[model samples]
Target chain A: MADWLSPAEWEAVRLSLRVAFWATLFTLPLGVFVAFALARWRFPGREALNILVHLPLIMPPVVTGYLLLLAFGARGPIGGFLDSAFGFTFAFRWTGAALASGVMAFPFMVRAVRLSIEAVDPRLEQAAATLGASRPWVFLTVTLPLILPGIIAGTVLAFAKGMGEFGATITFVSNIPGETRTIPLAIDLLLETPGGERAAARLAGLSILLAALALVLSEWVSRRVAARVGGR
Target chain B: MLEVSLRHAFAGFTLDAQFRAPPGVTVLFGRSGSGKTTIVNAVAGLLSPDEGRIASGDWVLLDTDRGVRLRPHRRRLGYIFQEGRLFPHLTVRQNLAYGTWFAPKGAPREDMGRVVEMLGIGPLLHRRPAALSGGEKQRVAIGRALLSAPRLILADEPLAALDEARKAEILPYFERLRDEVSVPILYVSHSASEVARLATTVVAIEGGRVIAQGPAAEVLGDPAILPAGAREAGAVLTARVAAHHDDGLTELDAGGIPLFLPRVALAPGSLLRVRIAAHDVILSRERPEGLSALNILPGRVQDVRPGDGPGAIVALDTAAGRVLARITRRSAEALGLRAGMDVHAVVKTVSVAAADIGTSGAG
Candidate 1:
């Protein structure tokens, strides 16, 4: 698959897949937890948390990236604490690109998960509780399995969004060939350079194909899991 | 005994009820919007009343005075919902074992094989809940609840969602649960036939208040507490399925008198509860010769309660059991019927709808 593309183009594709995979993997647990809290809990600041989580979706991607940079930049409080304490950083690094992609995709994942969680009949949870399953057990044994398809769909959406993330990634960790450049970032560079349109078009096509593949794979997986749980 | 005293007020309704139900099928019999479901939910710890005290014999589940309220899971009650809320994602086998899987370490688990056989759901073990019929779903729900090793079982009109045939199919399982299982059940129902068939203790509720509470026979035979008045009043009699004749007639011995009703699919000598509707009974001054009715129970009238309507309810101490006959006030006056009058109560064989017959809860 890499032989046909220029080394630079191939790197872009590889980097994008890695970033998206990491982004999706890291976003899932937090997304599910937040979605469940928003759907089923009645805590204070819930609406505020909801608005904050959704702000990225409504805000300009560059603005969200700027916000991320201020909080996670090398000299930033959280970044300085992390660098001094944990000795890790997300400033202009590949991790920063992944982090930007995750922030951009967080709301989409949460929305899908929250919708599915709300769709679950509370009576079923009540039934599980009456059958001697505590809250966490009810979630693990009933609610989680019931909402598997939704979680998968949300994951795939996040992954696809991650692959194409350009504005946030560029603003947070500027485009570098290997360090932070992904499919869209590489395509942007190729479009602007002298006689690089062909390579850019190829990369664009690759992004579309990858996204389509992710969607098809997620659909197939969701259907199979749904059938097991009798969701249909 | 399960003791409940709860008071909850809603926008336009209030529920203030108190009752002590002995260990059996204690049915909260009432019409819709009468707080039957609310009472059960309170007992199950699903709903917290404004103030209430609930105890299962020595185990105090909730007491607002002490600020003690156990969570629904910690209360260990099996609640069978009217809609059969089986886990849709689970196969029949998984749904049946779901409760038992979480049953506390020391809680006696109901045998999975026994539950599967009891509900006749072996063939459906691999199927999802969506594929089961309404009756089949309810049966599985019952199994799911029983296998939970619940300290108490709460059924909120478990059969209300089914059609007549489906209700009949599931009624026997509840009867078996009442008789065979040692756990007490708190059942809620608006149907008089279901209350008559299964309730060992009946608490009649109206407008969120328990108008009457006593043994099934006592509460069900009272016309005043009966929601539909005298029309819905019926007497429950314990009978033995004496024999099944070739002519599709099952002979049942109620007390010492033999009653020939439509054939019931029970082995001879099995316990059966026959609910004789008061309106279906005709009181005669003497045994009439060549009468076509299959049952002529000879008994003296205990008392006659005249209603504002032209109808009167005559309580009789027949050899079979305590039978009730609904005769017109004019008929009572014409026959000079009184407390000591000897009257033969005649019941037609076909008048007993098959739905009125149920398995006896004698245990």
Candidate 2:
């Protein structure tokens, strides 16, 4: 495999893996919280909140990137506030690429986790409460353990989506070597350059391998968690 | 001890109940949807009642009038749901220990070894609750409750989800808890037989209201209160095994009457409480001879109450406390069965099955 791919192809492969890792890591906790809220809570503007969480999936990838730019760009209101408060910037940076990837993958994560949370029996929480577990304890002990399979599945889905995220990442954070240039962006660049067919092919192969690995990991983790919880 | 007086209205039903029980097994007996579980939940601080006051011993769990309400975990009460409700991910030992994790540090810990032994769950300690049989799960659930060292245990139809064989398998453990454990228990059930076997006090509920509350014997024996009493009203008698005859019979000394039962393994001097259904009893003006029934006790009719249908229930005051006999109106009139009338009550020895006889302390 090393002989088949050039040095640039390998760098692209490494960059894609890093971007996917960071994207999934950044979104996991927020995804879980949003999934739980959507599954278990009823509040004002709940429907609207749900729609907003899922909007990235329905809208075109380029449109989602534009919206992210307006809200999260360095000069935008939220971006300006975050930049002033935390001295952090996302525009045209690797962090911006990760944010775009995460936004593109978020719907998949939330849907998977939410479905699992809904599948869990609420009676178990009530039982925990009767056994002297407070609300947080019950959630940590009962709810979290029961929905672990879903968490794993959602993570894998988000990670795979992040690895292949193209339109949003390219639109939000322009491709830059050793910065925001992920494998999909490299593949797009190679496809556009003359005599870059071999590099694009190698990048495509790496993407396929990573996607397969993610699928297998998801299945393995889900089964392990299911066994731990006595689920079939 | 528990004192609960509560009123709550749901969408279409209202629950109004008031009762007090001493330190023993007080059963909340009622049909489905009669709000028995609701009352227990209120006492456990799981549900907030619109108007109520609940006290276990000296601690006030809930007092709506004073705007006092304790959280469920803080109430120091153990609850056993119908389904056992053991944590699926935890082993039986872990599940049992889980209760103690939140219990007050200085509170007395009930003997864990004794509880495990009593419930016969020693072999299941390392296994998950899902791996155990229905009976074993319930036993573990009971042990978990006991290990918490609760001030009072509230069981909401703990046997309602089990089969008959499993029910029988777990009842003796409950009996042991009632007799040996110092903590009071509020047992919920709709089965008369379960109440007869387990309860020291019976609180009958119907249509979300408590209809009667008293000693198990009085509550079960009263013909006017229970529908079962009108058709099958009977008195529970406490008797000691006197002797066992070779011909598949055991003679018990129930007060002055020699109550004969089918062969049982109980040793002589062992105490038993027998429930003789009123329908199985026969009333005669004089002692009849050559009858198939083996139990013939001579007593005087204490009260003759007419039932709704075509029968009358005669309360008999024998030397063995009070016994109820349900006789047809025709037979009652023919025998001049009335209060203060002398009569002989005949009970078929075989009709009183072994299942109807429960062994308890020397009552």
Candidate 3:
């Protein structure tokens, strides 16, 4: 894998893939949960939860990364608790990059999933309840299957967004080789130096190829789910 | 028996109703906004009423005074909606099995093959709901509801969305369920003919109140309590197929008295319930010798009830059953028709449409 590209470029690509994969995989479940609650459940603090879930999307990505650092830094409350209780820290680490990407990608995934949940007919759920299924079983057997295509779409969007995440990842975990230096950060570094345009162009092309592949994969998966569940 | 008493207040309407449905098909009959669906929803726990005590047999479903309320899933009622809300993502086979998964493990298992054969939906098991016709979807909906092994069945105008042919197609299956299965049903409908064909007991709703409640024969025999007055009044008569003539006439023995109608397709000895509209019959004092009407039921008038208009509904206790005749007050005055007068009720042979005839019990 290192024969075609320089070692530094290869390291950046590998780290970016690792960060995006873990970020998207971890956020999928929580994204779906928040989406279902926002679309269906009504309680005293529902709107407050809605605004909280969407806060990162509306705020600037650099500000979001700073807030993450404040809450999860080594001396921060949560970071210090983890350092004493679990002996772990996320500051200036690859894990911090993943967390930053996931936070930046949360709203995209949730909004897609929420729209699908809202499109489902509540009467069908009522019919299921009358057939003797409890609320959770009704969601598992009927509602979940129907919204699968949307979930897949949201997952792919979050993954792509994570791969291109520059502002938050660079802000939270300072650029470093083989750890925090993802594709976008590496491209920024290469462009700032003289006689590094060729390396930067190759990395930029790789970014386009990776994003296009993600979209194609997403389309294929969503098509399969739609065929399984769509009435059309 | 299923007992329901509920009170609900809407913006401009108030629904206060009470009725007891014995084992059979009990129809909630009324106009569109008379709160028939509201009562059914309350019984199914779809909507919470302001105050209510709903019970089926000894099993209490809802009691506001006792602070006891069961959710819809725990109640185990099978509801058939007007639109036949089958899950579009599931095949017909899975839709039928969905309820069985949630049904009690030791409960009586409804035979899938029997229900499949009954509704003739075996061929459609692999197809999605989007591929089914309106009638076919409803047939599967009925099969799905039955396979749930429900304690009670609630049908909210299950046939209202279909055409006349489809209604005719589904009515027999409902009759089959009522006769073959002992589960009590609360059926909602505004069609007088549907009530005439399906109901064993009738509870007529008007202005969110139960105006009358009794056996189907007794309620349907009275024209004044009918929602549409004389225009929609009809009598349901139980009869037996006596013979089929070569001249395209089917003769029925109505309580040991032979009555003729257009050719019925049933074989001899088949029990049938037929609805005779009140406006279709004419009354005469003396036996008319040269009359073309084939049905001449000789019975003494039980009573004559005058309507709000110039018409009158005469309740006649024929040997067949209670029959109603809608006639003008001028004609009643001219004929001097009164109680205890023996008169021949004349009925046209073609007046009984094919939609009005239904088989009585299990085939």
Candidate 4:
């Protein structure tokens, strides 16, 4: 497989996996918290918060990416603060691609988790409270375990979206080879290059195989989680 | 003692009630939507009453005027919900241990081994709640609450979700808990039989107010106040197992009167409560012989309260304590049954089925 593919192609595949893994991992906790709050709590501005969380899903991927660039760019307030205070940067790097992908996939993750949270019986939580568990303890022991399958589904969906991200990654990180170019970006490059049809076909085939594997793995994992949670 | 006084106004209903439950199983008895559950919720700290105070033992759980409201967790009350509400994600062992894991330091804990054994849930330790039957789930829920080391246990219609057989299966465990466990229980139920079988104190709630409250015998003996129509009203008698005869009869000493019923499944020393429905008793001015009824107790009629119908309820102060007899006005007139009149209260042996009997304390 290494002999058939150019080193650049292998690097894109590796970078895509790394970016997707990090994007999914870093945003999972926030996704659960936001999803739980939206699903269970009632407060003013709840609908607005819900709309804001879903904005990236409804907007074009390029627009989300552009918004990310404007807010997290080198000179932007958040980016500048992080650069000066934490010696960290995200502009035009693989880290920037991960951020873009994570933002783009967040809505799908939150929606999945929120639905699961909503399905949970609040009476169980009340029972937990009566049994001397504080709110946080109840969440950790009961609520989290009950919603594990949904979280797994959400994480896998986000990872898959991150792996295939094109518009957001290109707009935010500019598709630099090895540094930021992922499988999709590599395929795009191959398709545009002169007499690159065979290479483009190979990359496209690989992308399909990878996406299918992710989906199958996600389904298997979800089944195991649902079984462990004793959910029907 | 558990004292609760709360006032909460819903859209179309207002719950304003107050009652004191002594150290024992205090049952909040009423019909559905009659504020039994509301009072239980208030006592459990699950609902914050608009204004009131709730105290269990020495702990002041809630007091609106003093701005002292303990959260449900901090209140340290074990609550068994109607549907069990066991955590589906956890095994029985884990669910039972959940409350103990979070119990505050120095909180008195019920021995887990004893609870599991008494509830007969040892084999289900490794099983998840989904695999358990309704009765098993409720047993686990009760065990979970017990292990919480709560100051009080609040059971809100714990048997309401179960079938008759399941209810029969779980009732003994609750009786054991009531008799053996040190924690006082605040149980809510609409079933008169459940109250008669389990309650030491009965608070009859109706339309958000306590219509009657006293010892189970005192509250249950009056037919007019029973939530169930007079037809279902009965007297709860606390009796001791006197002897089990070879002839398939178990004799119980109710006060000093020897009452015989179908064989009961308890040892000779055990205390039992038998519910004799008002309609099951027949009154005679003099002792009658050759009657098939196996039990006859001499008593003086204390009061005769007639209903709107042709039947009248006669309260008796017998050697077996207080008993009620439902007879027709014609019979009352023929026997001239009145206050302070001596009579014989006759009861058939088979009239009190196994379902109408429960152990008053641990055997």
Candidate 5:
């Protein structure tokens, strides 16, 4: 697969896959937590929490990246405190690209998962409780397994979205070749350079193929999980 | 014994009910929108009543005055829902074992082998709930609740979702549960036949209030307290199987009167509770000649409760404990049917359906 493209183009593809994988991996637990809270719980400021989670989806990707930079830049308070106290930094780093991608994809993941969680009948949970299961135990044994198909669908969708993320990644971490220039960034660079149309076309085709493959894989997995959980 | 007194008001509806149920199967008998499910939920701690106290013997589950309320998990009640509520992700075996996983340690647990045998779910244990029929799912649900070692079981129309064939398939298992298991059951249902067959104690509720409460026989026999215009109004009789004739007939002794019916499927000497519908019984001033009815009992009229319509319900003190005859007011007056009047209660042998007969192991 690498031999088919220029070294720079191959590097972009690898970096995109890595960033998307990490983003999905890191955000799954939090995504499930937020989704469950939104689907099942009621408390003060619940609407505010919902809006906050969805703000990135409604706002332009560049604005979300700028917001992330303002909060997590090297000179920013949180960024400075983290660098001084823990020797950690996210400014212009590959991790910052992943953070941007995760934020961009977070709402999509939460929406899919929350719909599935809401579809679960609460009467089953009540039945579990009356049979001596505690609230947490009920979630672990009953609610979790029932909502697993939706989680899988959500995670795969977020991963696919992360793979194609460009506006947020480029704005947050810039278009460095190895550090953060993912497939979309490489395509953008190839399109702008003089006499670069051929290379640009190849990279663009690769991105489309990869994205389509991710979508197909996600659909296959969700279908299988649904069949297993739905028992027919 | 379980004592429940609860009051909860919903939009356009209010529930204020109080009743004491004995250790046997206490049925919450009412119509749809009659707050039977709400009462069950409150007792299970699934819903909180505005002002109420629920206790199972000494254990106080909820007491609004004292500010004591137990969560559903801590209440140790087993609930069987109308749809069975089996976890779709799990196999039949896993669903049955779910409650056992949460059952407190060192408590007397129901043996898994016995439960599997009783519910006859051994074959389906390896299969998922989706593969089972409605009757099979309910049986598994009952098994799951039983293995929880619950203080009491709450069944909210467990068989209501099934067809007549499935209901017939599951009713005996419930009868077995009532006779064998020591745990009390609070069953909610709207079917008169179900109530007549299962309830040892019947608590009749209407419009969110308990209109009547007593032994099943007392509450079911009197048509005046029965649900208005209930066509299934009947009387329950305790009888022992006396003989099984070769011509496909079984003879039962109801308080020393030979009551013959088309063959019942129980061994001789086994106690049976038979529900005789009032419409099936006829009254005559004297011992009437055969005219096709097989059973005739000599009894005096106990009470004649006249209805607004042409019908009158006459309660009788017959050898079968208590029998009721729904006769027309004109016939009742023409025969001078009153308290202390001697009459022969005639019942057609074929009108006594096999579905109305229930066997009790305790008797």
Candidate 6:
């Protein structure tokens, strides 16, 4: 294990896991709300909302990072307000890295959850209302369970994307060691050092293993939920 | 009791309906796309009508004039849709329990065991809805509604999706619910046979209007009210089994008339309702001899209605009750039959098949 991961590499791996986990956790509930709105609700700016959600997917990663920095930088309006209200800072910090990763991975999460919400039968919701269940109760008991497989799929995909986020994280947080240096940042640093080809290879292998494990776990969880819910 | 008076226009069709339903099953009889479902949905609080007043007992469910529109859950009305609509994730027990969870705290608990036994769902409690047959799923759906302790039960063609055998299997359960449960029921159906067998009060709806409303027998027997007039028109008779004969016949005493039918397994003194189809009755100008038909009742022509096709509906009032006979125009012309004419109505004992007989009163 020591040969597989040096002390500095292990720290990077642990920090990357923490950032990915926090990013997925913070984005899931908002993702579900946005997905539901996109799937079921009709409004004046629905098309505009769809385009805005998909902008992160089409825009260059560095451009997205620059936009995030402009909006959430220390001197920016939102960043200044947040710092004053909560005594928090995002410029060149681990939290900034997490914010950038979450923004980059949000589109993937929203699309998966949106498709699942659309696939649910609306008639079932109407039936629940006729059975004396209110709208919220119907969603909790019927619609949520029916779309749980999709939620898990979206979560895993977002986590995997967060784990590999590089351009946005490095651009926003400036690759500070023992602070914002994630697995991708560490691998980049190793590639630039002298006689560091073997270290870069090791980090690359570790990233591949983590990504494969995330894929297998997602498949297993989604299949188990689908089987339990009696997939339509 | 239920009172609904409403008017609404949708797309190109206009719905103007008003009716009163007393205790027992009041059926909204009409064809498909005739606003039958719309009325029920309005009462269930799923659809808010433009101008309407709905009241059940003293509770005002909806009153546009008074600015009251109760939510669907607050209405406390149970609705059994065409499809069973069982929660896919819940087992039979869970589905039944889900209904009871929302019931008012002070409301009496409808016995879950009794509902299970009534619906014959005891063996299916642990099973998911996906594993049950269509008929079984419908039964569970009914049981779920009952456990909620609703003020009224609205069933929209509950048996429309089932096959003949499954329909036969579930019809008895609905009959029992109508008789045994104290709650009033509003049933919707287009099948004349189902209305004949189950309805206590029949509301004839055509073109989004209540054309006629009265007792099932009176409404179904009226030649002018029913579209089929004489050919498919029938009168519902409530009778009691008097005896079973060894010669393959069952004796029934309805009102004051002794009616004989083919062999049926009901014991003596058991109440039954029989639907005598109008086309099966042969009207004779007099009591003729050498007739092969076993049953003959002497009566007078109460009315005469000419049908659109080739037949004429003749209403005969016997000592028992009113009976309808469908006779062709040729026979009517040859016999010179008209209103107030005395006649003998002949019915073949074998024509009254066991399937046409219901074991409960008009409910």
lDDT of each: 0.90, 0.85, 0.90, 0.89, 0.89, 0.87
In model 5, the runs with Cα more than 4 Å from the true position are A1-7, A75-77
Q: After superposition, how far is residue B3 of candidate 1 from its true place, in Å?
A: 1.9
Compared with the true structure, what per-residue lDDT tens digits does model 2 show for residues A1-232? 5778767677767778888899999889999999999999999988998999999999999999888888989888988898999999888888888899999889999999999899888877776777787888888988998888999999998999888998888888788887788898998899999999987887888789878988998898888888878922
Candidate 6's C-alpha runs over 4 A off are B227-231, B353-355, B361-363
Going through the candidates in order, what is the number of backbone clashes in each? 1, 0, 0, 0, 0, 0
**Which candidate has the highest DockQ of all?**
5
**DockQ value for model 5:** 0.83
> Per-residue alpha-carbon lDDT of model 5 for B1-363, expressed as tens digits?
899999998999999999998898999998888999999999999998899999976899999999999999999888999999999988898899998898889878789999999999899998888999999999999999999989999999998899999998999999999999999999999887788889999999999999999988888877667653445678888899999999998999999899998999899989998888888999999789757888998998889988878888998988787888888999999998889989999998989987788887544
For residues B69-179, could you state the per-residue lDDT of candidate 3 as single tens digits? 899999988899999999999999998888899999988867999999999999999998998999999999988888898988999999999999999899889989988
**For model 5 chain B, where is the 10-residue window of minimal lDDT?**
B223-232
Model 1 bad stretches (over 4 Å): B242-246, B286-290, B302-312, B327-342, B361-363
True-vs-predicted CA distance for residue A152, candidate 5, Å = 0.8
- Give the range where candidate 2 chain B is weakest over 10 consecutive residues by summed lDDT: B225-234
TM-score of every candidate's chain A: 0.97, 0.95, 0.95, 0.96, 0.96, 0.97
Per-model DockQ: 0.66, 0.59, 0.75, 0.66, 0.83, 0.54
TM-score per candidate, chains pooled: 0.94, 0.95, 0.95, 0.94, 0.95, 0.95
- Docking quality category of candidate 2 according to DockQ thresholds: medium
Q: Per-residue lDDT of B1-363 in model 4, one digit per residue for the tens?
A: 888899999889999898999988999988899999988888878888899999865789988999999998898888999999999988999999999898987877888898899999999999999999999999999999999998888999999999999999999888989988989999998877888899999999888988999999999887568665567778888899999999999999988889999999999978999988889999998898989998998999988988779988998988777888889988898888889999999999999867679998722
Q: What is the Cα-based lDDT of residue A218 in candidate 4?
A: 88
In the predicted model 3, the residue pairs found to clash are none
Which wins on TM-score, candidate 1 or candidate 2?
2
Candidate 3 docking class: medium
Model 4: runs farther than 4 Å from truth?
A: A74-88, B308-311, B328-337
Which 10 consecutive positions of candidate 4 chain B have the poorest summed lDDT?
A: B223-232
